[model samples]
Target: MIDAILPPAVVAAESFDDPPAELFPEEEAAISRAVDKRRKEFATARLCARRAMAALGVPAAPVLPGPRGAPQWPAGVVGSMTHCDGYRAAVLGRAEHVTSVGIDAEPDGPLPPGVLGEIALPEEQEHLRALAASRPGVHWDRMLFSAKESVYKTWFPLTGRWLGFEEAVVALDPAAGSFEARLLVPGPVVDGTKVTGFAGRWLAERGLVVTAIVLPSAGP
Candidate 1:
């Protein structure tokens, strides 16, 4: 996923085909009261995240949920995580070189009726129909939802503001296997510059739809 979407220097990713069943004490407390299913997902995501951190030479550490339920990474690390049926992944990059990151995965399935109306703009729905007409096989509605989620994950850490699904327009390029999020609200400042949009990559394969966004550090 990292190689398909990000520059080699910008990020590294780790994934789990089999989710671990154990959770560290701290990680357990992170979702101590949640249901069994929630706990498993929580623990598995951390396991993936820790491995990603270790691969970057960072010490083993607990990734606890922070404000807005975003995973809090150790100092000097910027990363993201996503988990879906049978798939979980984490991507990490050095804070000095990467500003923020967001990743998401979803089962390749149709969005519930009326879901597209809620999450998509008028133009997006039209384009989605075209995509479905041509591609026909991929679940473009669900892919759009996942892409919007990835955008929010990338945006919140940068601006600390809420961005609704309708607030960001996602345009997918099937030819390039990527997507771009056009921010409809005031954008974030990166490298001292206010950028209007973000670039992301998406892939649909192996019964999953995955999307990622990496904001490389605008160096100080």
Candidate 2:
């Protein structure tokens, strides 16, 4: 399902059930004190990540969290991972072909009361309201939140900076199953260029809402 949204250069792996709790020594150290549920999720997400790595012909390595809880990928690789109830996914691409990748998955449900207002700007809220009225089947609020997550995930690796929920103004296209985020603050510089915004794709299906943003490499 994730592969459908990503480009051909990216390799994606997903699983619906938790695999056996297994982790490298370094990975185990990262969550040594966590509860069983947290351990399981961490282990399974790494499992999916390694699967993507193998597809990219890279050796399996521990995907430890770097600053701000972002996965630390191997040199020459860019990737992201996300997990939710009954779903875990990882997507990876070589740095030569893809500059960066970000992915997130969430339960296809409404955000808890009062949470939407906090994450969404006024204009985004107005747009979501219009979407809900016209097409009430999908949870536009959650989709918007997921899109922002993808935007942040894509931004951090490039800038090593924090992106608040209100920092990026997102617009979702229901018909295209795509979204674009316009940055409020200064954007990241990539390949001698400043990135002002990011465009990504979203999917709402099989009880999950998934979003992804992939920035292609600028050739030398």
Full-model lDDT, candidate 1: 0.84
Off by over 4 Å in 1: 1-3, 10-18
Candidate 1 structure quality by residue, lDDT tens digits, 37-132: 777677777777777787888997888888899988899998998888777778888898888888899999999998889999998999899999
Clashing pairs in 2: none
Query: How does each model score on lDDT?
Result: 0.84, 0.94
Report how far off residue 79 is in candidate 1 (Å). 0.5
Candidate 2 per-residue lDDT over residues 13-109, each given as its tens digit? 9999997856899999999999988888889999999999999999999999999999999999999999899999999999999998989999999
The TM-score values for the models, in the order shown, are 0.94, 0.98
lDDT of 2: 0.94
